[model samples]
Target: MAGSTPNDQPTTTPEIPDHVLRVHRRLVEAGHRSLLAGGAVRDHLLGLPPKDFDLATSAIPEVVDALFEKTVLVGAQFGVVRIIEPEGEVEVATFRADIGIADGRRPETVRFTDEKEDALRRDFTINGMFWDIDAEQVVDHVGGRKDLQLKIIRAIGEPRERFQEDRLRMMRAIRFSTILQFPIEPETWDAVVAEAKFIDDVSGERIRDELERIIMSPHRLAGYHLLSDSGLMQCILPEIEQMRDVMQPPQFHPEGDVFVHTGLVLSHLSEPSFTLAMGALLHDVGKPGTFEDAEDRIRFHGHDELGATISEQICDRLRLSRQQTERIVYLVRRHLVFMNLPQMRIARRYRVFEEDGFEELLELCRVDCLGSHADMSLYETCLGMWNEWKERAPSRDPLIQGRDLIQMGMTPGPEIGSMLEALEDARRESEVVDRDAAIAWVQARLDGRQ
Candidate 1:
């Protein structure tokens, strides 16, 4: 869906929320000038209601800090102060120009300047525009408002210079394009592809965060295609790139290639958590290696196993927490198991529920199937049975303890422990209906052996 566009006629204007307008007016009344800035302006021009709002001002950090009851010097050197109101928090930054960036992440130095320089220094044209609340006018220092109407993502200044200032912006361009459903202008896209390798200099945490946004965005498939097209995926996650053109059997997949199948799966995801999205994206990572040409058709033997291993390595490289890495690997490894859901016995279904990381495994399989052939009979059957078993079989303490077995003329050895476990399994499986039956079943087995 396209975002809402701002009113075009000079006399026609949409009503700004009273609270936000009052906040803007209050800043001006306190002898400080403020402009509704950054994303709010971008969202407004796109006719979208912004989720969060920020402000830019000509007031210096110390000056603005004294007026607000709650203020934080979020970027003091750059004249940025965070104002906390009961309703919300707003960032007010003094107009400034960056000196140069020694580190790719932060400005080496910042000097307070006019709005023009500040707008120019920003990453993208659409994000550079400002709304001057006091004057009730929109500021288009970089023609951002125009660019927004064009449905294009263009760098504020020279694409190369802007990328050099902060490498992560290259990824942001793709993200904004995906979020806005806008096309990245040719020059901007080329710049991102050319400098794609510099994305390595960015911290893993930052890159991971951007990746999560791209994968979780509504247009995740388009985002992935952009990443692949821009060559960023090759630099950041070559493992995903490896899936391209790897064929799957037409009998099952009919989806042509592994990459296309994966992309379809990503498109099917809805508000997927970080782990689920990443798991879906990497679920078939092993397909390339496992693909083999057979007499009748192609096959990917044990791709799930190898994909799990690859998922582990990728997570480790990204420095994810051990728990997260393990969960993702588990999900990838078991994604294909849903195919066996219908044939599983009730006891085995409950056992699947009890397995470590079972819930995540189920979700991965769900999206995987939904993305592919869209035939979900197996998933529906398995999930239904699994839920039914769980609901009916609330766990109860076992009837036959090892001590009980030992007291019944069984030795205190592996046999006793084994018998107790067997009884417990039988109870869970409904093979032994009651506590007495469980004990009798164990006794019968022991008696038979004797």
Candidate 2:
């Protein structure tokens, strides 16, 4: 619902994009009441640059389409239309009161109504405010202005009823709280905890999208903690919950438990890629399952190998793409390689360098060390070696092709692949520098085999 605040004024006027203003003006001129709504108004009040502008209007979807030169009926059935202009697109939703939410996601029926009814149906107070484009004033039908001032995320109406209407709002509340560095109102937070389990009822794609936003946020650690506290993490990622009291070898990890260590690592990540962040969170996921208490010391003998398998399963459950899953799994599997850096042979080192996503693997190792013992000796050594490898241009074109081997009267079989792999390993280590040398080396191996 869009209305003008009678007494309040914007501290700093936000530069409304041209397209949004045009749409609002056109709608108003056509005898429809239109105003900037939702997050755009919230952002403007906060003096932060808004990402996108959305308009709430008395005009129905058909009128919006008729008024705009180009319009997309993005959600026409729900009284939403996108006005496309040369500058950008603005979403204009007709003011409506939702009747029922049988699906727990969208309204089964919406009644076109005035601003107050529309404002009452929104999720949170901070998101329900509007800015009257014509009057140059702020609207606060749901006490949104006060909530924004207090830095609190409060549900617009009965918290339980609002959450029951849309389970994803539970995740969204956490996201907004963390991203804005605000606290959820006591009642709202309580309701979130009460309804956290219902989050699993939402689609995996929606869950994944929300999870990605939380993980990618600058305050991701805070978001993770909120998820855990609110019980949402248990429903979405129960494996992470299992890490709570999983003991680590104290000598190596003075940071208490696996969960604490992961949280610490997450804190150290500065401008992390999504894969790197997920890797940090799940790197030690195998420790809880493989914990061994021996007289010698605590040991997670093959946690890296097992963690990779677990990561793949998690990725598959989350419906991540094959490429994303592989990269994340690769990071989990190879996070421990830094420990072997000094002992690795030239061929092994070359092979490590040639693997995809080596940079991110190193970053994960660095943060992992930081989170644990804070001893960066291995990380530093690996980084230095990686730099040297980069300076030397370590990667080289294959000295010989499989077709060349087939052309040389050798039978095409598993032996061909084996021979090629061995030759490539030698070439990576600079044992053979040219095609002729590679041929001779293969011939010598074949001769020895004979």
Candidate 3:
């Protein structure tokens, strides 16, 4: 069966990339039924440019290996072979019906089957369809086309049974539903909520990836709500879930609780990067634990520092890259520093702009303000400082070295480094113009200390 694009334009066999098409054609001409399968077929009908064009074929791994000049057995046991063409790589997987999945990660055993059976064994209906390239039709044994048209995310078979095969599919369901802005079919939604606890059985890295996808999506607010509603948030990231209903100082955060503030921060962000989004999401992660009813008002006195530590742990648990963890943690810890930046000295304030992830910090600061109090006064002051610094763009390097301080009667120990820092600050403040002036300034500083 063939369907139409979102615009109701009649759609036929999906047109894959030329390199991938050659592989499909070769597999079909070899008497094996090869079809463009999975996301490529689904996206074609949705009038969107698909990311990858993977193929499914009736040919076994051995047959696929023999047919291609340059082939790689990516997953032979599962009947998947990679055909390396001149233009690109195509993964031509043999139709497989998985058996028992004891680990909930992969099939314990698989039986090579036809396209229809393979489609039926897939996780979701929207991803179970295939396009018969030569026949110019779709092979949808699971009613995937209809479900796609209905704007729904439904499992191929029994929703629970499908989820039981791979627990990560539960998160994936939310990811797909959130990204596509589609509602999960009733049975699928029920199964997800019921089996939410099983998500822990999935590896931390797997959960991290899915969670990253959700948080990084433009519809992250909706995804966050879905995760909380589906109970996955409690299992995967209880640290964040704890933020719910944590009250803040009404004078500063009249918007609502910590959870509401977080959602507002995330929603206000536009096209945020992974680090920025993660930074925004976990910026206040410490508020729940640090919440205190002080004599004056609600106070999360050291929430920034605590949140940074917690953010690091969460990032480490998720197996995030070391660099990204460092940056996100930096954002979390220093998020509140801008509140007092305007009061700092010229060099003291401008030096912050020179550090790594400063721009993102500035953006995070803006979004933070947008989420809370709508007070951009401090953010604007910092922005003006940043702009002034950019226009001047003073030397990031120090005007003088430790040796210069040593020559000015400063000892070789910690004071030399301090003097060098002071020298850079003076240079940034235009208090010291050149090497001569820097030397004099350091000499004067030593004289004053003495």
Clashes of each: 3, 1, 0
Question: Tens-digit lDDT track for model 1 on 1-450?
Answer: 144334541232335566567666767898766777788777765676766667777777787888777878988997888877777677778888999897888899898888888899999998998877656667888978678778899998799999999999999998999887999988998899899989998988888889888898989999999999998899889999998888788777877789999999889888888888898899999999998998988988899999999999999888888988988998888887777767776556666687888877777777778777778887787788778777886676667677777778987788777677677667777788877887789778977952
Candidate 1 accuracy as lDDT: 0.82
- Highest-scoring model, TM-score: 3
**Which stretches of model 2 miss by more than 4 angstroms?**
1-7, 443-450
| Model 1 ranges with Cα > 4 A deviation | 1-27, 84-88, 294-297, 356-360, 373-375, 390-424, 432-450
Better of 1 and 3 by TM-score: 3
Q: What is the lDDT of residue 23 in candidate 3?
A: 87
Q: Model 3 Cα displacement at 144 (Å)?
A: 1.4
CA-lDDT, candidates in order: 0.82, 0.88, 0.88
List model 2 lDDT by residue over 188-228, tens digit each.
Answer: 99999999989877987888888888888889989999999
CA lDDT of 138 in candidate 1? 76
Please give each candidate's TM-score: 0.85, 0.93, 0.94
